[model samples]
Target: MTASLVLAGFGFGSVAAQEDATTPRATLRIVHGISGGPEVDVLLNGEVLAEAVPFGTVSEFMPVAPGDYVIQVVPTGQPAEAAIVQADLTVEGARSYIVVALGTPDAPEGRVYEVNLDEMTTGMARGRFINAAPDAGGLDLVVAGGEPLFGDVGYGDASDYIDLPPGTSSLDLRGDDDQVVSPIADVTIEESLAYEMVAVGQVADGSLTMLTLSTAVDPSCSAALGLGGAIEDACVRLTHVAPDSADVDVHVNDVVVAEGLTFATVTEFVMLPSGEAQIFSVTAAGSPIEEALITTDLGLDPGQAYEVLVTGDTEDLQLAITGIDLRPVPAGQARLGVIHASPDAGPVNIRLSDGTAVVEGLDFRGVSEYKAIDEGTYELQLSPAGDDQSVLLTSELQVTASIVYDIVVVGRPESQTLAIVVLTAPVPVQAEAIASPVASPGATPVDASGG
Candidate 1:
């Protein structure tokens, strides 16, 4: 199957931000708060501090010498002379600060806020509010249905740190004459922790929003050590491979999880409740859930991910469920998996176009173990087991380092529609266990099925 590289779980890479406790330097964090802004690079004193930072991103705190410095924001990969916004700020030793790039891309603005990192009174949490919304003038942050917490905060300005009772509290942003501008709900304020809330976006277009940035309370900083990207909840993606089926909707527990999924297309991973039986159904687009063409009950485990393949013809749709491993592959290697989903193409063998056998006797509904292979391009050929005279499918696969490619053999040979569909995922820090048959050359095969 010929496939394009699909980038998943993309985010800014963390620059090394930890400094020795004895270092006489101030910590600085750059935040991308500009509405609809391009990916940018943050420069401190003419040097790049963070690279390729996208909107709504808050960087890890990096230590810098306490003194006056020039800050610049430029489009990522651009020259230093192309900075769209520039400002001068001074920071004190042993203190923390945040620089927010706000407003539109054409007319960017910056706001600086001094953060309180000092120890707080027991049972109380602290928060600093910054008004980054260029159009929301004179905002008052108040407890929802209660009193004001920070009053008359102007645009590009910050309010004094306010002590809040520990627990979840909702707040409202009020404008002139105490008119409610926006209601932010379910804010968690844990005791002994500090937070910064920045009001951003344009108020005239109803895009005014707040970003709550929290600081780690423990020195371990486990929450900051790339653990936030781990998959703690179970997720499943649905791929419509039934060649003759109409556009369909996937329903999980009577709720539509994916709508109008066309043939050979896959949906983004949908989060689902795990550790219990889930009722799954498929119906024609715009059809009621009761009119399901197929229904199945399955239980998924937490901390794992899955792919549900809908194969076969419209008259007899089949579901092939397979768990996928997302853990990172060994350095310089690529992971490969194969699934035999074509009902008409009975047990088949796979080999390189140059005559190197890779898999043998893989039957319908069979899924192969992910094999570690050297990253490169390969021409793959498949045919009936031990019969090289009849080549059923051949395609070129380009494998990149640290990527996982799962190829699904699909379509009906009788209708001359046989082909393959390739799905890919990036290497992640999380690992999951799954069972499937088939393997690369020299590896033992496992006895498993995807149906």
Candidate 2:
């Protein structure tokens, strides 16, 4: 005889009254026929009664209304196959019944992994590290919307973990020395859930540094201030306020025109020729503040000077200004340089002053060495291997005679979709500066080591 059990209803209300007004009621005692592991599911009348049941256990479903009802026995973790029994059984007011749950064949086992985060000490921020991509190296971590609890520190290993004060936060994991990574945000690090950080490196180089040029404009001056104008004309005179001595690069539009100008005074004049309208940009070489562009129009005059106050974007960070000059390039030459924080490798071009291409097919690694060519004043453009991927530098570089200049490109990582972290420029070669009989027309190719 099968070992069956009955489930008698022990309640204050009648089972028949609890059922649909016209339907009868029944009580059920379900039992599993065979089981090694305690994993089973019981469903009654098309509704799942229990999720998982223990082996050889008897579960009671009291006061079940009787009707054309179906009973299903499903093995845990297996939903495709189940045993069903359909019968029309009526239950007397106090009658009890038994339900035999026949077990099916066992199913295959699945795998899962658990992730955990260690509790952080007080006053410390909660932090985690992940290695999503197994291949790349040098991940850049960015904390958006707030300052990092821990200042600029490198995470060397892919699978390594870091500690921070427990709280809700988002993080980005980038490669190429933090130049390219993924942003992971809105991660709720509950006291229970273990946080797993993944690190994925960028496929290409990452943009590591940004050069920002900040200059306050006089509200009264108006003349469409920028970096381009007539030959031998002065665009804006920028007074040097920091780093008594340093090297600077001047950019008209986005194309670099001159570099390596040493400055040792408080006032520096940046000269631009007339005829073309463009924005003027400047940046220091080998300094943390490497690139800066003029976003506002300078409304410059031929011989007027613009006083620019230099300050650090953050406290404790030094404001170093290098290189300053006021000059114009001769016609037929174009000034050029690499975009400091660009993400890809490709050809860089310059529109000449004489409706011709001054520099063509110039290749640059982001953050590498920059070169300048003597092309007449026109619009400068940078294209990355294809016509669809080109960014026009803001101004036309008015080329004049005899004046050498530097152009610095400033790109910020936060503003870009892709980040490049590796060094893209050629290695700089060391050489002594030899006095040439005549200064070169465009950017004089300095020793590569100077990059």
**Candidate that would win on lDDT:** 1
**Lowest summed lDDT window (length 10), candidate 1:** 429-438
Worst 10 residues of 2 by lDDT: 426-435
How many pairs collide in each candidate, listed in order? 0, 75
TM-score of 2: 0.19
Say which candidate scores most in TM-score.
Answer: 1
lDDT of 2 by residue, 1-451 (tens): 1112222212213224333221223334444433233466765655776667664454533445434344455566545244432333333432334444332234211111111212233223333442222234444556665543333333222233454443666755455554434455665443212233333222333322211111111111111123232222443333322223256654555545445544322223344432234454556653322346323233434333233323222222122222222211112222233322232333555433333343455443222232334324445454444452455443555544223333433333234422211111111100101101122122121111112
lDDT of each: 0.69, 0.34
| Candidate 1 error regions (>4 Å) | 1-232, 429-451
TM per candidate comes to 0.45, 0.19
Clashes of 2: 75
Write down the lDDT that model 1 would get: 0.69
Kindly list the per-residue Cα lDDT of model 1 for residues 1-451, writing each as its tens digit.
1111111111212223323221234556788878778899988888999999988778876656556667888899987678877766565554556678887776677766665655455456778788888778899988899988899988777777877777888999999789998899998876545688888877787888788876532111111122222233455778998878999998877777789999888876655656567778899999998899989987776545578988776787878888776543333455678888887889988777767665678988888876655567888898998798799888998878646678888887888888878887655211111101111222111111111
